[model samples]
Target: MARTTKPLTNTEVKQAKPKDKVYTLSDGGGLQLRVKPNGSKFWLFDYHRPYTKQRTCLSFGSFPDISLADARHNRDTSRELLAKNIDPKEYRDEENRINEAAHSNTLEHIAEKWLEVKKANVSADHATDTWRSLELHIFPSLGKVPIHKITAIKTIDIINPIAAKGNLETVKRLCQRLNEIMVYAVNTGLIASNPLAGIGKANQNPIKKHLPTLKPEQLPALLKTLAFASIKTTTRCVIEWQLHTMVRPSEAAGAQWNEIDFENNVWDIPAERMKSKKPHKVPLSDQALNLLELMKPISSHSKYIFPSNSDIKKHTNSSTANMALKRMGFENKLVAHGLRSIASTTLNEEGFDPDVIEAALAHTGKNEVRNAYNRALYLERRKPMMQWWSDHIEKAATGNMSLAGQKGLKVVSQ
Candidate 1:
């Protein structure tokens, strides 16, 4: 013989008074309103532990916070768990922990962790560029999403817009980067497996395009346009410096005064700034030296030879030469990087040793031993060849039409 409990109503719960001692008003099925002597009311569900079968109580909330309707809903949920031999308390705690982890393990957060691990293996500039690409492409949409919840379809939706813009290369890189992050998550035990393993297979591969460059004969016209172009003197000097030095735009722009060896007539670029991650010595032609002398008054106090107009502590944008080339109406005709191509073509056509030309360009071949030997063997040979290239540029600057017709095109080793 058991006494069945009556269900509590909202009116009864609201009007229930507290006694000198703690007491409960049962609503059946283990749900009760716990009225304390202090007059505070709470919803409690008494149940047996799943495995131990020990009796215990789980608090839903206070009466006003967990209203009669809300308390009944929670009790029904707890009853379902009990029928499955699951303890409601354990289940709730596990759910809370999972939610906490999801909030903390966002995609951006995990990407940052992966980058920290990445920084040790790559150059500083490469690491910075990698993070910047992620910020520009991936972070706006998927940054806040939990790492585990990121699926391939959602990722493709985000990347499809970039692909539609004909920026297939950017799409390819984004897919590769996302997959790297997913693999990192899997390795770290943050997620079960990588859903983005083959994400790059979805994108159309980007065609490899070389930088637009001018023919050797066209250097005269290009130099003439640069001389009279309506651009800053500092910008013009940067272009000329890169032209004479045969270095990459970023390497030229980031040149520091300390890197110059005035006695040796060379510019020693550190390994960190180089693409091959090796220190390189460029023999400074008289033309390159003249460009340096011109920049001394303007940037002698700053570390960088071409300091930014707004911030003297930093170098000017690497694109300054490119932008100037565009403003001079060389858009799609030539780029700053193409300046290197011009120098390479001219040097090769002039019949200098191919090894010396490659050494001058700081190019590394697949053979590590040969590259090391060339770096040591070619410095003296490269100096005179660099001088000859500068003399050719000088002739072009003065409107000398063709390389074959130019005089003093000889390399005399110093």
Candidate 2:
């Protein structure tokens, strides 16, 4: 006959003394208080593996840390697993592995990992702004949530209040960043799917405001003033290059020498630097080339065609040209970005192919397929159009706007 184990009391467990050999005080149901020869006491559950029928011991915890009642409860839980044909130790191990994965795959942890991968691809200022925005807004609310557990509804809850505060643009940007992070998480196997997909549809659209720009008649006076302005020669050249190319102010300010191909007469802005995330080819007009040659003496020593006067190692700030424009007393009348508007308006009215003008401006297509096709199709037409625009600007600036039949270019009153 098999013997039945007796239950132990709290007093018996506490008062149990260690002998020369380690021994256990049974609390029935496989629960035991193990007393070491050196006087250490621990609660352990002894059981047989369900399949192998082999005896195994699992520690509940130290005595007092795990009271007698708690040990019995742990023993009963393990027995339940055994009854279900599962090994208690294996079950515990699996639970611990799942918990470890959950702790490491929190939204904040995965966002940091995603940011590490992005830091190399984006500009330093952009990367810094992205991280700062996350820290200030998104992280405070969602950082501790497991990436897999975050839902679209929860994301909206966090961002909608920001939109309600009239920062819809910020909310839109935040949603974009979150979508990128979640997409990274999905690609990396941290999450099975992106929860923030289509999140922008939930955000309020920001009001669109066009930048203040010059009328056709105002261009000549603005150009004449810029020519005689007491600003730095580099600033004048930046403004001229921007006007000729119709590139964004940031693109012109951050221009690097290596991106310029004087041999091909092209300025190849890298995909990472461009807002469109695709390489842009700007066909340099002869006038644009002349401006470059004039700028070479002042900026040739630096990597940037328009290096910052305060820090030659870095490119000029995007605001330099705009500030120069402000100083020229065109603060509300015009902006650096307005150059693109004026160029686009004038070129469209001058009978240049709209696609060619768009290509010269480096405006991205509505989708990937169209963008790829536009970049290849409009290269040749953009070359001649660029030259004509340059010549037109010079003629207009010199007060000779009557281009009635010159090179098939026509001037229309605005």
Candidate 3:
């Protein structure tokens, strides 16, 4: 006849004393209370390995910490798994691994991985700005939250304070960057799907504010102010360089000597330096060439044409022109970026070809075919327009009491 083992009770378990040797008190159904000579007790479940049918023991925990009821509950759970031909120990280990992964795969961790890949596609400054935005805004709230638990509601809540402060533009950018991170997670199989998609639609759209700029007729005043401004020679040259080239401030600040082709009169800006992420060939006018010639004596030894005032090894800061303008008493009246607006407005109002002007500005188009045509056929046609624009600047600078150019135009304030 088969023998039947009685289950352990809470009273009996608590009173059970350790013996001289190690032993176990069965609680029936493969459950037992193990006691050592040292008086330590542990809960064990003896069961057969699924499919293999080999017997092994699974540890639930220890006595007092794991009560009789808790041990029975664990035993029942294991028995259910055994009935389904699943090994309980294997299942527990897999659960542990998954839990560990979910804990480690935080939003900040995934964002860091995504940034490593993102840095290759964007400029260094842009990549740095992107990370800084996260550090200032998003990271404090949800950075450590696991990617799986990241919801659109949580993101909206985090950015709402920024929106409340009339910084919808920052809020908009935050949403864009967060969405990129989520999409990255989904693509890499870190998460099943993006939860923060279209979250920007939930917020009010930001009002567009154009940078403070001057009218085409007001060019003489700007040129006059810049010519007499109490700033460094390199700062003065960079402002004129940006004015003549019509490139962005950062592009002008980062100009390298190798990019200039004195023979061709073209400045070949690399794709990485451009906002459109395409290489641009700026047709250099005589005025632009003169600025380079003037800079040659000061920065001929360095790689950059516009080396920083404090650090010759590094290029000038992108904000140098703006700060110089402020010191010249044009604060809130105009900005370094407004220099492009001055060029664009003058070129467009002069009835120059819109496509040629856009090409000069390095503005891209959505139509790939037209973009290819512009890249091929626009270079020669843009030369005359560039020269015309430079001549216009020369005309404005002529009588402005500056070092170079002839004078005829009168200074007019806004």
Candidate 4:
């Protein structure tokens, strides 16, 4: 016959003195408190494996740390698991392993890994901006949260305040970063689905403020100011090139000497450097070529047309032209990017084809089919339009803003 054991109360267990040999005070149902000769008391649960019927003892914790009631509660949980034909110890070990994995695979951990892979694909400045955005906005609240626990509703709550504060653009960017990290997690088997998918529509639309630009009448005075400004010659040439080509400030700043083709009178910008991810051809007017010739003396030794002032080996910062404009008392009034708007507005008002104007501005089409067609058809007309624009600028600078050449231009299909 099996030996019968009596349950012990917490007070009786605490009052019992340690003996020469270790002895167990039973709480029934395989839960017991074992007191050692050194007076250390431990709680253990004895159970039989459902499959093999082998007995094993699983530690619940120490006495006082885990009270008699807590140990009984843990024992009941183990009994429930055993009733399902699962070994209690194995189930507990698996639970601990899952918890450990969740702790290690937090949102911040996955974001860092994602960023490390991303840094190699994007520009240094772009990668830096991404990192800074996470550090400032996303990391503080959700960084340590397990990726699986980050729900769409929770994410929207975190980002809605930023949107409410009138930083819809930042909220959009943060949502994009969260989406990327969550996708990375899913791909790596950290989660089942991305919670941040379609979160962008949840944000308020940012107020649109067109970039500040100079009017057609204001261009001549701005041109005159830039022409004789006491600034670096590279800076002056960069500003001139930006005005002539109407390319983005980054495109001009990162221009390489080899990208220029004096024979063909074009500048072929690689797709990687372009915002549209499509290769662009900038038709070089005679005036543009002349500006390049002037710039060669200053930056010819370096590969870039506008090499960095501090580090000649690298290209000049994209902000070089804007900073130059700011120092010329045009802060908030004229930005380097505003030159594109100036060109778009002036050329359109002058009756030039909008397609030609957009092509010259290197604006990408919204759809793939339209973009591919625009890339091929716009080049021919853009060459003549570019020359016309340069001549118009020259005439305007000489106080002849009324030159008539707007009647013969062909309008392309939209």
Candidate 5:
């Protein structure tokens, strides 16, 4: 037995009462509106497909947004699909799934999810840096777009504005961060493409000022000025360690006493925290050994090798190193990053292999083979290399050019 609903006037339908009464409203086609007792209206098509005998209910949108006429139009269109052997409800479900997936897999949403997933893996200090760059520089601009929609033009729009203001370093870092997130998204099936893959270094503002390292000759003067910068003890320790071992400043700041082998004279940085995602074994130089010895008594109980009593949580900020340069009047001339430059420059002058220097700095490459091959830290080999380097800096900081020959020179016992 089928139930039939009476036709209703426009005014009656507009002020429809809630009951078991079902009002049938014409939708200008074979589709009709069925109003339930709850006053919720739904549109259903009554027309059979042109060639098919099966009657299907093609759902149109809800009452308010979709007018009765449009509902009828959509129902007719669905009927056409039915004629072509397609189940409209099933097709609509597939389309809805795709739309929902797109909304979820949008670039900004996925990047944020990636951040949340890695929150514990990265340090408070490192996590904050990555977040700040994305929130302030990258996300505000491109946060809503789907990751695959990220094109070169969009990248330029996001990056060039910052680059024009001489924030080339920031731009470069933002690009790297974007690449990291997008690559993560691609691997996880969120996106089919990476915006950062294959774009050469030159494409990212190649003409910008490249950070330079202190030459072997300049090391003496630079060290002298850096040590005497008259700032916090933490800055001095940071700069000294930067020169002593040539490890990245962030790695040095995050170093723990347990990671440093005082007896063996090595700082084994875990692969997770290292920039290259490979373990780095930093051989403690004579000076590095001395520095640790001095620091042992200061913040001995704290986990951080270079701890700040100012706060129990954070070790130290990157600004500490830069401010030290500013105090020594090398503000723009020398930055915390320049310490890496100085190390790279001096290592080359001292005749160490380029690959060794690259490994020491934890630089990863595009070639997976080369990257895996160069991950070896060469600790015993790097020991004398670091020791010679530390001694070389000490001589220069003391203003003696004759100290250059003294490098790698062993003292013979009488």
Candidate 6:
């Protein structure tokens, strides 16, 4: 039943017919080619590895391009590698790893690396909002697709639905963000042009400007619970301080212990930390002072005045305090940010210098000449205004408003 052959012959290969016979021809010392009827031939080599007793079959290339003679030569080379106690599978995997690593140095990979680098410069809230616009709404549809594949039509498809949902602002913001990301991508040679460029003529709906600033009557109930009692301690203090200082919640939320000068009752916000990217000094009101004094026992040992109650290393998540407002039944009723409207309105009506109030809130370039001359101009005057506001707010929190103060208020009838 066993006929021994020393070497495979081309005549044997040519005479083969589909499924008729599978010829096992010994090419050399160990290599064999199983010639099939379908004209398909495969090389199989069996030999004992140097360190292992188990004999394994090593597959070389198929016939023609790999003749039986060459298979024998390759089999010898493989045995040489095996004699060095090296695994062919492991060696193949390592070679693949090197190739993959070389390929990962492409433009697309570098763009992602750039995004991670830029993330450190942006606030956590803005970073979340930006990445959401990029990843969910943008990426799945275009992620694995090369960066260059993003054309105007494709970008339009991605943004049009967002515009149609009456969220024109979000779409616009997303477009702007994509432009920025792609421009960075372009500069890094990831792509040539920003596909988002000049695509604005698309039928994008307009952004809705509906901030949740409350009516005068609603401010008291909002502040009352926020000042002393209802929400969690960290939440309450954050909202109260937010109400006290008209700065954006990000500026307040990211506040470090070193930024405040409690002894002087003056808080000088450094330029880099300011929304305007200019130094600002907020005069601390008695109420703002009291709020800080109360928070000291909780976080005096830490760097952030209000260290995230959740962890020792990380600051609070940007949404924690805002979400607290929604939980307290102030969803769309009173936004944590609407406190800016309260300050802008209250300060303007009080007959305190308009410029001073503007500077206190760190509004930039409203008075170009004044802005140019004075960066920290309000530090001294901001102190009294801040304290006066603390006094005025204490009255509001207790439901006692000066009638003179009431006249300037625009009351929305409930």
- Give the winner by TM-score: 3
lDDT of each: 0.87, 0.84, 0.89, 0.83, 0.70, 0.69
* Candidate 5 global TM-score: 0.72
lDDT (Cα, tens digit) per residue for candidate 5, span 1-414: 865555434565466555678766664445677788887877776655444556656667567577655675687787688678777777889999977887757667888888887765664557778888888987787888877677767877777778778777787777777778878888887678776764325345546676544556777677556544556666677667776777776787777878987678788898766765667788777667767766667667788878765874557665677666777877567777788888788879879988777777767678987776656545556667777777666656553222122332122122
Candidate achieving higher lDDT, 5 or 6: 5
Descending-lDDT candidate ranking: 3, 1, 2, 4, 5, 6
- By the TM-score metric, which is better: model 2 or model 6? 2
CA shift of 122, model 1, Å: 5.1
Distance from true position, residue 60, model 1, in Å?
7.0
Q: In candidate 4, what are the lDDT values of residues 291-344, reduced to their tens digit?
A: 777777788999998899999899999988999999998999999999888888
Q: Best candidate per lDDT, number?
A: 3
The local lDDT score (0 to 100) that residue 153 gets in candidate 1 is 89
Query: What would the per-residue lDDT of candidate 1 be over residues 352-410, giving only the tens digit for each residue?
Result: 88889989898888898888888989999999998999878887777422112223212
- Superior by lDDT: candidate 2 or candidate 4: 2
lDDT of 3 at 320: 93
Stretches > 4 Å off in candidate 3? 151-154, 198-202, 401-414
Candidate 5 root-mean-square deviation in Å: 6.6
How many collisions per candidate? 0, 0, 3, 0, 1, 7
Q: How many residue pairs in model 4 have overlapping backbones?
A: 0
User: If the candidates were sorted by their TM-score against the true structure, best first, what order would they fall in?
Assistant: 3, 4, 2, 1, 5, 6
Q: Clashing pairs in model 4? A: none
Runs in model 6 with CA error above 4 Å?
1-124, 188-190, 225-229, 366-372, 399-414
Give the alpha carbon lDDT tens digit for every residue of 131-227 in model 2: 9999999889999989888999999999988999999889888999999999998898777888899889997688876798997667788777875
